[model samples]
Target: MKWLKKSVLLIAVFAVGVVSGSMIWTSSANNTGLVDPNRPGSVNDPLITKSYVDQAVAGQVKTELEKQLQGQLEQLDKMLADKQKEMDDKIVQFQKQLDALISKAGGMTVVELQPNQTMYADPGATFIVRNGTTIAVSTDANGIPDVTGGKDLMDGTPIELNHMLIFPREGRGIKSTHSSTVFVMVTGGYTVMNPDGTIAASSSMDNSDQNETAE
Candidate 1:
């Protein structure tokens, strides 16, 4: 009887072990089935490594910075263009003013002198005898400058018709020859006087103003 009882106990322990093993194997199989073989590391999809997050953030920052820098460059180009245009406009304005000032300063006119009449010129006056006979008269020996002929005219030198003459200093003049009515084009300042040295007509000028009288 004792031997049978021991054998029965051993059989019972073996059967229980077999049943427990079978149940444990079934539970393990069920847990394995819950995990999809197709989805490997996707179990925790939201979880990412520090290196991967840093790379993603850096790429975004670089893109944003590039956009900002491009916009700044474009703005700078526009500002420079505007400034250049403004400078161009200022230059044009200054040119126009300069032209007007020059025109007013060196205005040209025609003067008529009768026989024995004299026309006294200020320094740097230009003259062109258009018609009739005339003669140069100067207080000093330096005389009047014949710009066209490239020579100087002393006192009583016959004025050449249609030649450009520049008076170098004050007290220099031209007198019409006897019985001739002289017509002359004049620039800068001058005064026409009758034979008695009385002023007939005069143009206003500053005595200190000097012009480049030579070509």
Candidate 2:
């Protein structure tokens, strides 16, 4: 029994010695700067500084901000491109409409005739005798069609002022019968001639007169 008690006491002392040695070695290692400041993530040096954490957070935030900014810039570029295309399309459409309106205007022209001046016109020519006395000229009995009066104007008939007239066939024309000058609005093709039959002015319209119906 005494031998058993001595063995148990030796074992107890060995345990206490081992615990004290371990604690002393750990304390001595800490005091001798065994913990590496360069390795902050290590268990022996687990402390993190405020500046390091701030730098890491700032880097992450900067990366995220750059990504967001790039995305926004790309979106803005696409939007701008779309708007430019839309504006270009609108410009093209507006140009087409303007061209159509100009073409449909029938190329109106105002012609002045001196006394005894004659104006010969092609088929589908429209005329509005505005001033002075004017007379219709035709080869056959059929003369200029008076759209407002709804009848064929005979040759040598004085055209009414401001009345719209249309020549249905070629080789039909009008002459200034008044002593003063005559002013006429002509659309389509026409040629003005002096008293000697010399051409004073001439113009040709490609399209036919659109306004030929009687009122």
Across 74-124, the per-residue lDDT of candidate 2 in tens digits comes to 999999999999997797567446534544686667666779989988789
Model 1 TM-score is: 0.45
Question: What is the alpha-carbon lDDT for the whole of candidate 2?
Answer: 0.80
TM-score of each: 0.45, 0.45
**Model 1 C-alpha lDDT per residue in residues 27-84, reported as the tens digit of each score:** 8876888645445455545557899999999999999999999999999999999999
lDDT of 2 at 169: 89
Per-residue lDDT value at 96 in model 2: 49
Stretch of 10 with least lDDT, candidate 1: 206-215
Off by over 4 Å in 1: 1-106, 205-215
